[model samples]
Target: MKVALFGLGYVGCVSAGCFARAGHDVYGVDVNPVKVEILRSGKSPIVEKDVGELIAAAVEAGRLHATTSASEAVHATQVSLICVGTPSHPNGSLDLRYIYRVAEEIGAALRHRDAYHVVVIRSTVMPGTAAEVARILETQTGRKQGEGFGVVVNPEFLREGSAVSDFVEPPFTLLGGEHERALDVVAQLYADVDAPIVRAETRVAEMVKYANNVYHAAKITFANEVGNVCKALGIDSHKVMEIFCMDEKLNVSAAYLKPGFAFGGSCLPKDLRALTFRAKDLDIPVPMLESLIASNALQIRRVVDQLLRWKARKLGFLGLSFKGGTDDLRESPIVEVVETMIGKGYDVRIYDANVSLARLFGANKEYIEKEIPHIERLMCKTMDEVLEHADVIVIGNRSSEFAAALGRLRPEQRALDLVRLLDEPPESERYEGICW
Candidate 1:
């Protein structure tokens, strides 16, 4: 495969050199003449472990070259990887000037080229950036995507210091686009790389980088805050965290990673409230911990807002359980949302594959009867029945069936999703998620 990389910065340089070393013919393109000259002379413009040697070897073997001309690179390569920078603006939004400029250059280059080229975006962009880039390319080149040409968002997860190693052994490789041919071409390029490939829509691929980085940042802040709390309490923070991490069964891990309803269970809500209350009593302000409940409520409010904005009256809810694969309804945060909507006189129905009225005759039944009797009355016999009767649908659980239900929704019927159902949202008249 002949590859053209349209940036000679950190990600671009490493990726070009590494791919060249992997035996693919790689051409590095950049606006900077100095960077192009350095790469053309069998040297890397950016410093990284093993990158300089790798670039030297690939260049010496005649597998790698660099050019300032986008047209030359596009003409010589079957696939082009856009590795341009997307820095932040003053308001913290993405400044996509570089992305748009590089895309226009690529599109203009494609106008003269007859081959069906695959343009892979390896830039850290916002959700809609890939689609925007594709639109720009298509409009400029007078070519249709997935037909005259192809586009994909194959985000790079290479860390700066250990980028070479991360590239060779990535945790996962994500390819995003609707084009099957484009996916295949990109997949085959990294077929030798030892990592699981996750194919999704271009927007999802673009947003995954933001999600990963933000989560990492959140984890660091959370740990530091916990350490601060421990210091205030005269407790050993490291020892606490060490013990906390040991509970992989419940804590410091995937226990909270699943996307479902807003967290409201006896343990989470009650414990969070207790901890915050305790912190208040101690006169120790823990904003991070205190914000957890507020954040959770905000997510719930977002769902409510979506449904209300759509003016959905006959609303159907799939899964009453806090999460699917469980029958526990105690303190389910969605119960509050449902109850609130019911109080406002919206005809609501519910269908939980796991929860049946017959199964809930003990304490659970008594609790529901006393606390949320309206919900029990709204419960439907089947998912199909709920879909048949409702004007809107709310997917609040991570059930496997919810994915299939997305296709079954009518154009006018809105879906307010709390759990991310499809890897990409369906192209429908009405579909929304609280957070995507």
Candidate 2:
């Protein structure tokens, strides 16, 4: 396979070197003559581990070529990989001038060629960028996306320190495009590499890069805040984190990563509040820690606001507990929502299999009688009674039975699912999700 890689900067140089090393004929295109001359002399244009050797070997083996001309690079290759830089503006918006320029150059080159060319975006861009690139190609070449050219978002996940290994041994190869033929081209380019090729929506592929980087930044900031509090208390931050990471079932794994309603239970909200309060008392500002409560409040409010807009007078709750199969209603976020709706003069019917058991013969009976007598007054026995009495059904937790209740909903009744009640969400006019 022949590849035309634009931009000979950090990502460009590393990608060009690695792809060529993997036995592909790589033509690296750049506007800078210095980088081109450097690569032309059988040397890497950038300083990276194992990249210089790869470029040298590939060039010596007559597989790698570098030039300042896009025409030459495009004409020499079957597909183009845009590895251009998308810098930030002063207002923090993405500067896509370089990306658009490369798209134009590739489009102009494709006009003269008869072969269907696939354009792979290897830069870190925001969602909808690939669609815009495809539009640019269409305008320049006077052809539709699948006919003459196609765009596929193949976001790079290379950390600066270990870029060579990262390129060849990524966790997975994510290719996003509607056209299978274009997606297959990008996948085949990584066929020699050891990673699963994930074909997803173009917008999802583009946004995953931002999601990954922002999460990494958050993790680092969280550790720093934790370290600050630990140092002030004369505790070993490293040791605390080491022990924390050892809880593979909950802490260092995909436990609460899914997009759901506000988190509330016996432990998380209480522990997070106490930690943030203590950190504040120590004069160590942990904004990330303190912001969780405020963020959680907003998520709870978002559901209420959306419900109010629908003007649904009678609402049904599928699960009353913060989590399913637990009788504990202490600090459940949905309880607050229920209280708010009742205060707003809305008719509410609640049913939770676990809470019903707690109300009858469980330990939560005394607390339920003393604390939430109003919420307990509205409790129903079965899910069917709640579904029959309400205009909008709200699934507050993953109770498993709530999924079946969704199937039995009447045409007039709409369901607002806070927890994703289905493995694959239902596509219907009456069905809605808090976050999908």
Candidate 3:
């Protein structure tokens, strides 16, 4: 395959070299004569890991060539990948002038060609960018899309320092295209890649790069905040987080990563408050850590608001403890929800198979007594008792016993799942998820 890689910058340089090395004749195009001259001399313009050597090898084998003319590059190649930069303006929005220019150039070059062409947007842009590029092509070429050419969004996930290795072995290949033929052409280009290729909607594919970058930024900020808090306490934050990351089941895993209700338990809320308080006493500011508690409190209030909107007076809780398989009630979030519902003059019944007055002892016992003093009145002997008495059933945890009672729920008796118990949403209209 003959490929024309526009913009001989970081992405374009690496992409052209890698593609050429993969047995494709690559024509590198750039507006800057210096960049073109450097690549034409069998050397990479950018100093990336292993890119210079790869370019030298590709050029030596006559598989890679550099050009200053888009018309020549486009006419010689079947596919053109736009790797131009999308810099930011003063207001922080994308400056797509360069990308638009490339689109016009490609569209102009397509006029001289008779074969169907595949144009891929490998640059990072917001949603609807693919459509905008398509409009530019149709306007320039005097030919309808899918008939003369097709556009696709194939986002690259390469880091700068390790770009060559990252390109050779990517996390995954994501292609977003409206035309089946175009998608197939892009997929076949990466047939040698070892990672999985995901075909998604054009908008979804375009937004994925932004999501990845933001999440990476958030992770760094979170780690730095934790380190600042730990420094004030004379504690080793690295060791603490290292241990914290070891528990893949809960922390640093997909266990609680989903969007759901507020988290409450004996440990999370209590330890977080204690840590933030310690940081406060030390006169160290950790706004991110401080905001966690406020955010959690808001989620609890949101649940109360949702319940009130439903107009359900009698509420039945499937689990009283913070989570399933636990009798501990210290700082449990649902306990706070129940207390709020009771204050609002709503009838509430709690049933936790693990939690019983006889089993409660120490701080756990005292905590429950202070929160819900008339605990004996609210406690139900069996799950059957709670299900029969309430108009709305709130699933507070992922308990196995809750699965058995799902089929027995009546249409009038609404079920609100605080935790996403089912992998997919249940097919019942009466069921609702706190957050989907």
Candidate 4:
């Protein structure tokens, strides 16, 4: 396969070299003549581990080349991967000039060619970028997308200094677009690569990189704040983290990462309160940790606010088990939300795949009956029954069936999402989120 890689910067150069090394004929394209000349001379323009050697090897083997003409690059390769930089502007919005310019160039190039081409965007962009790019291509080429040409968003996750290895062994590969044929073509290009391939819509693929990087940054800040607090208290933060990491059950793990009801389990809510209290006692501020509870409560408030704003007379909740797979409803924050809404005089219906009224005979049942006795009356036999009864739907868990049921929402009904359901919700009568 002949591949055209746009932007000969760090990501582009590494991608070009690695793809070429993988037996694909790769052409590096860029607006900068200096980078083009350097790559043409079998030298890499960027400093990265093993990238220069790979480029040198590929160039020597006649499997790679460099060019400044976007049209020439597009014409030479069957698949074109846009690896241009999407740097920030003054106001912190993405400077998509590079993306738009490259898309126009690719579109113009396609106008003169008769053969079907696959354009894959490897640049980091916001949710609507891929569709915008496809629209640009269609307007310029005077032909419809997924018909005359193929367009897809395939975001790259390579980190600096380790791009070559990351390319070869990525944690996962994401492909997004509407065209199944184009998806198959793009997937086959990576058939030799060892990574799980996730197929989604264009927006979801565009947002994946942002979500991943933001979470990574959040993790770093959280650890640093924890370390700072420990240092102020004269505790060994490293030893604490080491022991914390050992517990696959919860701390320093993926336990709390899932999108669900705001965390309100016995340990998390109580421990956070205790930690923040300790921080206050020591006069050491932990804003990030402190913000955790505030942020979580904000999510709950948003759910309540949306329901109120929708004027929903009756609310139907599809899951009550804190999560779908668990039976523990002990400190489930959602129970509080439901109880509060019921207290506000809104009728509520609930269903959980794993929760049974008979199973809740002991403390759990007493807790629910006392705090949210309305739940016992509102509980339904099945999900379909819940869906049938309410004016509004609230998905509080990551149940696979709930995710699937999003498409079944009525035109006049509203969905308040705590967990992101569909990548891009269709424009319906009503749909809202705690966060996008």
Q: Which candidate gets the maximum lDDT versus the true structure? A: 2
**Global lDDT for candidate 4?**
0.85
- Each prediction's number of clashing residue pairs: 0, 0, 0, 0
Give the whole-model CA lDDT for all candidates, comma-separated.
0.86, 0.93, 0.88, 0.85
Off by over 4 Å in 4: 249-254, 314-332, 338-361, 364-436
Q: Where does model 2 exceed 4 Å of error?
A: none
Give residue 420's error in model 2 in angstroms.
0.5
CA lDDT of 15 in candidate 2?
92
Give candidate 3's whole-model lDDT.
Answer: 0.88
Q: Per-residue lDDT of 86-166 in model 2, one digit per residue for the tens?
A: 999999999999999999999999999999899999999999999999999999999999997779999999999799999
lDDT of 2: 0.93
Q: Each candidate's root-mean-square deviation in Å?
A: 4.5, 1.1, 4.2, 4.6
**Please, what is the TM-score per model?**
0.80, 0.98, 0.78, 0.82
Give model 1's TM-score versus the native structure. Answer: 0.80
- Residue 364, candidate 3: how far off, in angstroms? 5.2
Ranking by TM-score: 2, 4, 1, 3
- Cα lDDT of model 4 by residue, 225-266, tens digit: 899889989999999888878998877667767564587766
User: Which candidate order results from sorting by lDDT in descending order?
Assistant: 2, 3, 1, 4
Residue pairs in steric clash, candidate 2? none
Clashes of 4: 0
